[model samples]
Target chain A: MTSADETQQRPAGDPAGPALDRFYTVIPAGGVGTRLWPLSRASAPKFLHDLTGSGTTLIRSTYERLAPLTGEKVMVVTGDPHRDAVCAQLPELDEADLVLEPSPKDSAAAIGLAAAILHRRDPEIIMGSFAADQVIAPVEAFQSAAREAVVTAATGRIVTIGISPTHPSTGFGYIRRGQALGVEGAPSAHQVVEFVEKPGEETAREYLDTGDYLWNAGMFVAPVGLLLQHLAAAQPELHAGVVEIAEAWGTERQQEVMERVWPDLPKTAIDYAVAEPAADAGDVAVIPGHFTWDDVGDFAAIARLNPAKEQDAMTVLGEKARVYSDQSSGVVVSDTRRVVALIGVEDIVVVDTEDALLVTTTDHAQSVKQAVEALREKGDSDVL
Target chain B: MTSADETQQRPAGDPAGPALDRFYTVIPAGGVGTRLWPLSRASAPKFLHDLTGSGTTLIRSTYERLAPLTGEKVMVVTGDPHRDAVCAQLPELDEADLVLEPSPKDSAAAIGLAAAILHRRDPEIIMGSFAADQVIAPVEAFQSAAREAVVTAATGRIVTIGISPTHPSTGFGYIRRGQALGVEGAPSAHQVVEFVEKPGEETAREYLDTGDYLWNAGMFVAPVGLLLQHLAAAQPELHAGVVEIAEAWGTERQQEVMERVWPDLPKTAIDYAVAEPAADAGDVAVIPGHFTWDDVGDFAAIARLNPAKEQDAMTVLGEKARVYSDQSSGVVVSDTRRVVALIGVEDIVVVDTEDALLVTTTDHAQSVKQAVEALREKGDSDVL
Candidate 1:
């Protein structure tokens, strides 16, 4: 494996910090992001887009955010179709660190494969798995929380960075924190009681009032060998399949083994395959994340993250000069390189792409998935 | 002058009947139709578009509607820029009958030029001036009403077609019909008391309840000599300029005379220059037209005219198969040859053209003119 010093040619605005020893960042770069249709098509998913108008793509931002901590120890696991796109967007990623899945088998298989590969290379390595399409603010805070999670994971426990709830949002699952672990160098680390599914409005409010639940942002950190052992006990078939593929990862049999085993791996999220079972066994710990984080699940969430300056001003995600709005408030995702004019439309969302255009309201942002489904039913595979 | 029989090679679907002898139809085609922007621009105005999706352009439909009444004696007066497009769309128009204006000098100048030329050729000929961008249905009713108006005009009266009001619409001016003229060939012909401007909502409702007011659709019919006489009395300078141009119309000095006098002609609508003053003089007569007529002013009017089958369905003006709507109700003018997807928007008006896009609502349809004004201010003449 290449040393961290060799990959430390950092960009100007990147966070300057010392690289953590034995720390590897694993990014699960998938999900079609259907709620952001026309802008987030299956051919070019959300991870590949600069959705926040931040000049860099979401995956690129993810890589930049973690590069100071992981350096050359970063790996990305994505499906075959997006392998080239992922590689193109992230040129610094080593060929050996980019894992191309033969087929999608949900989070458990994708993340588990990365953990098994890193464990095989360095048994004592601590790996943190983060989604490539999420947004986190205040790099210092995120780095601090990640450091605590890594420290907690070194004690042979599966660690997750639980985001502190800013509001009673029902869009994300909740993690209920129990007693504090009182471990050295990790003050906020606590034993996780359970992982709960997304709740109703009233239940979400109740959870917020109790102050025990934190938004489960799916950020997991643990020793690579410990995660593989948990996966081996909970999902033995999926674990064995990924381990077999990981064993031939850098060899001539890598492609052959991936094709034979990946297709048969269990199609399940890591939460269902390992996290919940590990919490039941009292092996799960959580470090409360003080930094702001958002999954950017829909345009409404995106609007919330990047709000308009005025109350009724439109939030544009592309060239601001290309959009003209009058008496309208909402988000506009413009990539068509054409002028988009909105008049007297309140809370409207306009997304302009090359082949298709979407006109909806921020309230109907989630229903954009149905539009993608309708397109699929109509055999619009070119756009899909 | 070409006789009616010499110009009777009408198309199949045209109103089939004997052409009215000594009658001429003068269509004034102008107006940028800025209210329907992106779809209607200066280069390609509303009259040139098949807005109704009825396979024929608005001007061609106007020509087809009046073919039975005017035959080959039809004349279209339009701006010089649109002369070639008009001739291309209307193949049957005689070269001598297509009057090209030097520039847009409003309806009075356009119609006066046609009348002066027709009067010079045949003094006793009856002429009817109609707009090229209006939609009138039930051709037989329109023809019958037009024939009566022509008979009324032969009596040397400035005859106009007053459309019977279907609703209390404040978007159109009203003509108060007084005592009947009781002419031999015209039964529904009445003396015009006055021509009122577009009224307020309450005034419009009162006008509809009175049963004495009819919508002034700007359809005027009169003898060519009588119309020239009215113009000479009401707008002497405009009438003199058009007459000078008409005198040199068939001569080699036609372009020179037009350039010398046309720009100096009064830039006024026919209502102000002729109809209003003529009504005040008690020289105007109206023939009540029972045919349905629509100016197709804005997207709201278009939505009302072409309502979707379902209550919450989207009304598409282009390929309906290319539009996908879910929980939305509105009008979509998709001329870009791309798929338009609407999700959870109500009363939305989306106009997609090749160069620009407009997203507004039915309530803000009139404000689209503001968008055009803004684009013009930005010097986006390519779209304007």
Candidate 2:
């Protein structure tokens, strides 16, 4: 087989790092995924779906991909609603690893909760955090890169893995890489010059052309001490609250402290509350990773990762469709129960769920959040 | 309600026709609707749909619109399979008026069948034949025009109602008027100069700019003898065969003759076989009618007939949707069964059916036939 074809056919968990004795991979799997309405409802978010490839649910794929680096050391953080689905999908995770938040909280609190529990077990342990719904390929390459990033983080800098930009995509925040720190065989690490959120298409194109911007893939390799220190500097109250909770970890009082502290924690993205501040403070570093990656942000991106046909590449099966294209464009994803036929259409994303179907050109996929916002304004929580 | 609205309201039978006469509106309803597919299926053809106002089906509406002209004098010619649906929609028509053809021979054969049937009842009977799926306003105006055309037909000319063109439309054929016939207190009657097939957009625009051309609304007023005579002069074999079938009317031999003769018919349209030839012979008359009329040829035309809102003029429902230009300009029909949200979309026909949904720009609706042909090629007879 050709190298490209072989790369496509790599079995899950094969050709990667040895199972580590002390490494833990914590998946921050708790997100409402409201941006991807209908398909990614609160009941079934991105991770539960086999969105990336055939027979590979996003969480299942994530666990299998990470297994080579941290076998039996996987933990998932979710909330009360998706807790069952998460555990049911990953039954191998023990009860202690299934940390459930009593309410819907932001990623900062969830990560802080995971950190508190893991620190109680081993204060100096290195924890590599990954999101549940991401497409990272070339397993061997990813494992090697993760190992290098973790080692760099062990030396005290908070390490973030930045994916090479394949397109000028405004959907993702970008990491501007600074001067490199030498790491043999692995791509060099750099100081994160700045964090730019969802730039305009023209700006994204410029970033792609410049060859300096990396997509913030949201994967972090850090020692608990460094993450807590960064959090303390950025959000002193959250840092103190998490520290007090960690000191009282495994107790009912710890749960009380968490419930009291989390609501008070500003409902801000990690990019704003921690990553950006750390980078500004000159303590944040980004390691360039060549592993094929996708954030699967919207239906269009998901459609791209699992190319359907020629013009019609579908991430999911649609009934009796012949997808032909002039270029790698157009996607038709519908439940196998119904047939969706597309013809002479281009650059459009069609996602069909049981209740609601979305048909938008890829250029407007990011504005699908607008569709959700419209739905919420009309009080359509059933679809939201 | 206004008289125009009342005329438009009746979807079952025409309002001004003969009182409770066993109306059998002969619906020549068997076009491939290649210009309007996915929504317009072979089994459910365009004529069988309620393409205009709510509740009034095209066939039913046609029956009502023509009722003022031929009260209880309606007969339909359709392929055998669609006979059940035709009857289900208009229960007033007797089974005898529902002449079923073995195959889709063409419009000429279909109309010939109706002519033969009418000849058997009364050779002198004035037949006002119109297509079953037209949206015509001002019932009183149409009734007055029909009465005039019937009188004109009695005066020995094959009378065709010509609509004054509102726009340069490449989608329809054009009729040019010759010398004006001084008709009293009525829309002017004229000698038909010539019949032109669909012209180029530029030519259509020129024709629209000139007031002499009228849209060939396809409403023909004729006595059975006059049509038969025209047919005899133009297509002698068909005329002779139809005469034989009429002479052996309501007999088993008549049915046998029809079965044999229809299959042997040249698969020509009426315009090609009779109307165009009659005009060449200088024996056709044209009457300009003032009533509003639409053929509802495709989704775009259907959208045009819908009520306009804010000049954006697309028919829109769904509180969650922020429709910018959902006037009748681009008909978007979706069931309240599901929330259909459209954003930044315009001039498109988005139809959500129970089994299949079609989303195509109004201009592209003409290509919907390709979608249907694909379904038919795949033996999706149920959908087709």
Candidate 3:
């Protein structure tokens, strides 16, 4: 039911919804999302799903969210299997900007490849790489943050939009913001002290208590050349490979180069390959993102993104889902037209698809992958 | 995939395998069974489905369990909706012995009508009324106990097979045993002091502590005339209505009489109309049954009856069900070919049907009816 027109509409006179003459938005759309199995699968990843029951799928929403700032300067990097789905969801997308990977790689290769291609196009253009499967609310706030990050990135710093921690969540990595950068057109810009791994419960609580930490949402706004420079230093082989592919991109050799070299690229998340190392070298800047964000990591996160329709009751997704919840508080994501009835269960998560069904609780949402693993062991590849 | 031939095999030379010339078996196959919703619907009650994956449906198993003793004298009384399914499951069942009720009625009406009809056929013959949805193990033991009950019932007493309580369960009613009856060939027969209602936990524990209590599994064997005599005394209106229907049975007036009188018949469980009243009048006898029995009351009881296939794992029913359990223990009753995967949740219960799916836990199995009630409130009658 979602309209693609939402991605084309630009708010007038909005501080960040104006022409960003030399800024491009790169969307890295990859992730098997096994934790959301049955709803999300290897054949069709989470980015292609409207997990929140929102009209648009996650990737479509991402495209629309970033469209106003980048206009036609948007690029989506995805795996070969999702090429048609991504194109179908983003009809306005230019073929020249849609990067289809030969196979899945880590965030570093995906984002690095996009940056290298953008750098080859225009060395001075500032590019922001955002993941395709995350959800953010109050578009204006995120746009304002992106505007600030873009402005801060113009000062030769790799800027990242850090989300203010809503809770002491141990599932996400933490970004420590240091002194204010005092940069032009960016009041919230601060120097990054360090990028920390997911913390233990005690340390996370401490981080929340001190209020000096923000969740590293893996959003990067930097001059394409600066990101490529950092990538070349931290992951030389991956950088060389993506650069080799980028050099032939849009040429007849594009698919040939990607298929030959993509698989051997060093697989690493963008945080480890660039952000963390650059933070250690004092070459990273942080822009606070006041907007709500979630990676749509698992059913638990999906429930958070799509709050319960009734207070403390349930969050249900799917256009044709007929769910009757009685004395139950949980999440139900159904793709089929079947009626799902839940009674007297708290914090439960039920994912119903045409071929498979998953039943667990939010407490075990992270363990959903264990079921997927078991299915793989049993050679139930049809479901996988 | 379950073979119906299992319902025809009779153990040769078993003590209760043959030669009960004047006995008949009455199988009462009724009950909406909302607690097992999606699996057992109002259209197709629990007795019509093979719930235990035991190669025979509940009613078919009940029929076969008593076939050795009663031979061709078994009569099944059910609502109109299940006529075809019942006949399909039991091809050997004579059409003359199949009694179809026009609508849902209480046990007193279903079994009492069967008893009244059998009374009209041969009042001197002993008749046993057994619910079609229960499960019993060690058929020989149950048959022996039933043999004793029939011999004891021959002495003009209403005999109930009282299963020895294996645990302090508050779900089933208790039958308090008094002194031994000392009847020949019925060595375990005893006087029933009373038939108690389902007790509270504390009282049930107390009943278990003392060995005088046995679970009243609603199995009653008696002379056809004796049960009707008690029924006529305790519930005169229901007795008259069924007796009127029986009078016109097998004639052109059969359907006309049942349609006119069945709906308005006094609705009452047979236990209240006969056994409890007979016990009060010191006309009831108890026969100790040393066999495993389960009413398949709810998912919890179902999980117990169909124990987990793997240790501390799960119990899954449905021949085409593709289930992968990982670090989870639960019960899955599927009627479709869906792959049901469970993660870390324990004691979960999932029922996947073609149009409806139910997710709960054994702890809340009884509350499944609440979902059904909610669905009814929403006027979702098609799935109901």
Candidate 4:
């Protein structure tokens, strides 16, 4: 069955029996957007900006997009700096839905945290992990695909929503789809064969042409039992650490367990620590997401999502404001109480704040965090 | 002989040469620096900035550079908007020396005005015309060159100073030098065969390899009578009108003559109006410039003049700074309040102003005024 193009077309009627009604969303908002510096500082990130002028951020927009599939069953896990902003921006999510990370860690830790929290609420809970920074369009289709993924997860297989590859993008990792999985009427679900690292452009082009490679969008759906079993079998150390942190969930000893366990845990991505292992286990399933998706990694990608009036331009705050951005372009944001002008410049970013100014090229936007490291190296801790 | 760089050296044996010498200096300060825009505005040019860190603006610096030969013999002729700045910067010059124009009629009118003024003072007075933005090293050698030119001008010939080109430069016009025509012991001065405009890269390289072409630095010394003779013979309208204006100097009616005459003056270069014709007249001579000279026309030229510390990069106002400016260059005016960084960018100009900001590629710096035009288009008059 084909889903409508517009997001608002909710399913009017489904003569088939109702699907599993126990899935909940877990938003990993703890990741920092180091590449989009100045705009995306330590206090804010890509998910926080109203990128599309819809008066909503990516996190808030993503939640609204999933409303039909799992109404009011979402949780946001963020750090201290963004905790207040997340709550302030999304007043609908109560304090209980906001999971605080004691310190910054990888997505694996976040997955464990989400699973533990869901286990406490319901041991058999179907959990779907969503990244706050991703953009998924055609909401109705995403909802339908996600609903199918949740149903597949209830069947004891770890399910991931793999985005259909639209281009030969070298920015994202690829998921090789295998033999077709059983979906009553949905063409979006498949059995995942393998997970590949970010490939060369030539290889990515091949995958795009083949139509079997799906972008590993870093979204997944699984039952608490299934995830815990995978973690226990594949990553026993992480499983033990998660268990320790979860046991201290509602006590004064919570910070103690977190502090002791987090720093010592291995730093790895969920793809390397779980998805790759799951693919090897031969039981993992892939749900091909029938939606437009973007992981705003750098200025080039950000410019694409917020396409300029011209071929490669992107405007930020002021609508009347004009930009001559190329595929390699950023902007000049001046707080000088006067109009700022940038001419004949490409690939560079100039972000002016009330007190501080950042002028660097887009290729170096990711290394801005290294400036903080430099400050620390020189013992200029105050700057950091 | 190539002279050693020494600034502000004068006669040890003949100190009191010309107390009120009839030597006149004409400053062509009409250019709108689009490359250095926001800093170098339409109202303010590079000659107004203390760009060299010697406590003098470029105009003031040029004045200081010529102080040895033309002691109190300076006259600054600029457009109406920059008249006050020119006057305010060079306080030693009288109000009469501050020649204001209705619009930028260019070098032809400026030279004509200088000739008229100097002719009024003394028909045989030697006049030296200098651009307000050039940087001349070794003031001592520059004065020596001017002294030689003044001696040559006393014989009623147009003495143009031709600098020995250090590279195959396509930026400046070239003067093809003929056989030498100076005293036995004096520096080499040749007859100028022809003046060529900025050439293509290959032509410039050919000119450089020939070793007979010197960069036409736009500096010239000639007697008022000689310039007046050529102007009357060729551009008779401009000459006749300027002569009427000169004869009625300091009278209430002179202002009328200026208003009536200047508005109708042909828009042309002094090279076209006098030098090219004078070459056919066989009265133009090229004296080799003793001092190292640079026009500081664009950012690339500026970078070549002011080489970077580590390599050949130009860093301006870089303070408490860690910079890696190289073949990929930019002006980094560091605010101690903020850390500025750049990477993988080439031929860029970054200017930080209190009310406006400008960042442009050096190659595109010429179009930076277009950014100002854009600001004007957007009705941002204050910033423009």
Candidate 5:
């Protein structure tokens, strides 16, 4: 593996200047997206879908959004099942930059493996990890915030881009910002007071009223060495396992080591294993991001992102001409070639797939996962 | 043409004695069933569907219910397009008994033509006309009512089987009953005072409270000659056209006369052309039916006929095993072999077919026809 100091240089097309020359984007692309089924199946999850009807898949959009800042320094860590799909969707990504996990070990192992690989290649590389399934609007604001976060991460603190809350959302974890860091290159950087789990509606409303809390978008930026150090201190076994895999990543023994050690790695989110513990130690910082962001959590969230042409018409995510609706409102994910007719329904969510069909309302979007579970329990794996 | 005095006799399966010996059933199997939409298209309408999950199509169920009383005396009157489907569904019907119309000329022409042909075959034959799409439960009560209606028709009056009201439903028209007829064999028979159209909720409630009104289920029984005489007096042109078609029915000129006269015949319902006017002329009698009957007008009616196993489960018209529902109600007509999962929807109507899908609620079931119209307007006849 070559070091950043020896191989890294400002790309000709990079408009962010040399300040971001050493920045690398690591995208953790994995999630079953159970709530979005039958559109998002286990074999083809949400990250592989062009959910916004924008003619680009979510992973492709993520790659495009970060390409300007990181140039060719983008790496994606996905499960083996989705490895080919991710590569096919993102043809611009270098084959060497695609890290395929043998099996899911949650966000902790997925991101930590990418961090280990980046650290081995360039110890000084400032890596920012974004989920492949999120939707971020107003690219300029995200770029500005990411640049500032990268600058702050160079100062040896684990940093996260906190989305400024626009509503009292109980879906995402809340990050409480304490005192201002007043860092020279990053003026918006603040000391993360504490990280809290997803709260109840009342607590979320209180969080909005307090004006001190930001939505923890699960986006983190840090020097590869610093993130690895936190991981080593908090979860030594997981850290050591990833380190071994990273060492063999570019060698002939890569597949052999992965097959032996991958499944044994601890299954945990990075927040519980690193960010929370690091925040408790007063070694965490946050950059307030003004850009809009969403995990595309459910159909209701998808409806909000893609508003219907008319208030009463459904917002179709596939071929709009195939849908015939009257006095209906909400979202329709139509992947099938057949016509979908919605009449006199309100706030409905209809997902028409080839082998399965889902009909529900926006209010019960989260309960779709229960249907998936029921199907699995019934041994109907073909649909799942 | 032979008369009933020479042809009518007790068949091998005749169970109602000699009074019903000359009785025959005429089922008018027309109507596109537009409100059911994709489940009931113009090519394959609702009459051919097993909407109640009873393992029998609506027309087949109609035949099975009346077969005990009429034996092989049952006749189906349908347009040329549905002739094959009606025959395929009802294999027991004699080829001579299936009255195939060249084109749709509405109820007056269809039923009047059937009556005209039956009058020519057996002038004393008492015929009862029932819709091919209605669901009549507790066949015993229907048999008893029809027996009384036949006896009342023998008294030279146009008798109708009126469904006793179970609720203040505004869906069906009300038939106001007059003084009870002092007849021995037909004790429940009463003189029909008048026929009223579908009323408002308050008016329906008032009618229900009066105890003198029964739902006009459009079930009429009369001697073939008496019905023709009423049609001849009320709609002379339509009567002449059907009479001309009937005169040529069994001859070599059957096809020629039908093609020439069927399209030009007056398109009017029997209620307007004969029944309502006959009631004003003091010739219509009413036999109150105690059996439960539904026209299966829409998904709401289907839900009532096929109640869900659990309150939260969907009332599926197809294979219930293919449906996975949670906190959902109303009905689902799944013709496709795909799994349908409904979550958090209330009173929803989801009809999944091979070429189209319909998603709505029971309240908006009537509006499904609008979707079909819209699809037609958009030149999406493939789905319509």
Candidate 6:
């Protein structure tokens, strides 16, 4: 990660600076993240935690990362329960810039609402939709890509910052890249051929070999009007609902209209409602994001994001974690002052929180959701 | 275990009951149990915990198991640190009956001092030394074996209640059984044999098949005078230190004398200082015990002692533990109100305490001692 001064000293693409003036980074903060359970919870989700063991929370880092590029031009779309927490963690965020959802309706509604509201604020505002819980590094590279993405977005095309595949991971969806768009400031911009679902290991490995596939990290930068235009064409009912709420936003009728129509918005992800269809219609472009990134998908992903200090040792995490490991190789996440001892276990993950503890190996980290689901069924929702 | 009423109604051996009148059970509550750490601390130790989820601690159960036979003739020998805990747990125990060692000198000094004291209490009293951190079942069978051991001890032969081998376990020493001794009323008594160190897997299997070996539980039954005589010959310096302390016991100089000599007493296990030597001298006899027993040596041993409800599942232990597991088989011990969720790990062990946590697997449970040792080296003794 580069310092703020360093990033300011080297504005990614100096000439692309004017393009960011009309750009607003829309942070869609949501997801209980059951797969990262015990660490990620209903009341306090993934974005609220410092999953990387860095001093700052994921959402705060997200805000910090984009602040340099977009200045104070940012809006956060999150669930109602997390409003106060989001406000507290990112104090610079104004209450009015926070778009609190009545309930989750997935990516389509969450990001669409943010785009709709930003579009209302400024019709031609170029908006970048970045989830609050992703881990990214090499700030300069990310900012460089964002500049290109903003430039591409201004070309009346919905642009996504697609990450290059580092492994044959089946955990994320893939985006097939096409010929470069030859946009002046956004030289890396390519036509997005299509977006594919998460594939099997064999196919994922094959996708890696092609050098044409990038991980669809659900990040998008586009003119708010273009995003809303696509949503209006593909999900008209959902588009009308978000448009109504956006029109009433900041007015005395904001709460009244949001309570009336927000709950009934189409529950879908942006990938299905807009990105995919837009790609087919040759309206979507991709900017290959060269920066390292992780969604903190699960403990397995966490293992990769934070490598162990030793060659064959567990990755110990926490602000006050007292860990002692011997002849072991795995991951230990402690949220308390408790001393965690890991001995002779490979790829194991131990997550210790205030109210709950989660133990599993990296191989079986995905199964953690099963335990959470079982807890919910057993009325152990308090821990869940 | 048989109920007190049942055990009382059916005396193990009616004639042997009278012999228990002069029989005193010495409870050696020592060993920090580094292998069972987090659950067992320097201040708490393994003896202080109820590893079996039986609602009673190992020490308390040891006392209760022998109470029906020895009445109030029970003495606990432990380190000075555990004085309050041992006293609080066994309120029925007399103050004088609790022998607090100023420092650890291993089993030789501990059990030797107990025998020396009991000898002064009653020269003719037969003493049985039992550790306070082992799990045992079928009180009737255990009592029956104790009865036979007592009967044999009355004959001036230092006797051992050896547990019949249940598996080819390499975790415990093997007592190679000699030919049977034609002692009436003590049918299982065998002639003097040899005490062998823990054997290799193949050797253990061979010993098991031969039906000539029993797990040396380190449980000894002998007349106090005879026990002292053997200790006097084998560990003369240690024997003298204990004798002088026993002489000063109940007098004003007791504390002064113990503080002066106890620390320097020879630190050797009773198995090496007495049992093996006694067996070589043809002065030791074995009483084959048919009851289940475990030293609770490590989390792996804990896995065996407390099997999971499901065949392929983890063993969850703790009175107030809130654990949810899925597709994982191992051991989980939670001492706090924290809910523990286990998923997709085989033979894993997760121990959560107030200030410490331990994650491993049954296969590498013994390696926990290495972790504890590392913590000690790091000077993190507070958690230890």
Question: Runs in model 3 with CA error above 4 Å?
Answer: A1-19, A52-54, A119-124, A155-157, A164-183, A188-215, A225-257, A260-284, A307-312, B1-19, B165-182, B190-215, B226-244, B272-283, B309-311
Worst 10 residues of 5 chain A by lDDT: A1-10
The predicted structure with the larger DockQ, 5 or 6, is 6
lDDT of 5 at B346: 89
lDDT of 3 by residue, A150-226 (tens): 88888889999999998899988999999998986789999999999999999999999988899999898998888
Global lDDT of model 5: 0.88
Candidate 6: Cα lDDT at B88: 90
Query: Which candidate comes out best when scored by TM-score?
Result: 1
Clash pairs detected, candidate 3: none
User: DockQ of each candidate's interface versus the true one?
Assistant: 0.75, 0.19, 0.65, 0.33, 0.71, 0.72
Chain A only: TM-score of every candidate?
0.93, 0.81, 0.92, 0.84, 0.94, 0.93
Alpha-carbon deviation at B102 in model 4, angstroms: 4.0
> If both were scored by DockQ, which would come out higher, candidate 3 or candidate 6?
6
All models: lDDT?
Answer: 0.86, 0.70, 0.87, 0.71, 0.88, 0.88
Q: What shift in Å separates residue A384 of candidate 5 from its native position after superposition?
A: 2.3
Cα distance off (Å), candidate 2, residue A287? 4.0
Q: Tell me the docking grade of candidate 5.
A: medium
Look at candidate 5 and give me any clashing residue pairs.
Answer: B4-B122
Off by over 4 Å in 5: A1-19, A166-171, A174-184, A190-213, A276-284, B1-16, B166-171, B174-184, B190-213, B276-283
Q: Write the per-residue lDDT of candidate 5 for residues A120-174, one digit (tens) a residue.
A: 9988888999999999989879978998888888778899999999999988899
Residue lDDT tens for model 4, B254-278: 7778887888887788999999999
* lDDT (10s digit) by residue, model 2, range A42-161: 788878876654576788888877775666678898876887898778878887788777676687877766776787788776788898887778877787677667666666667798
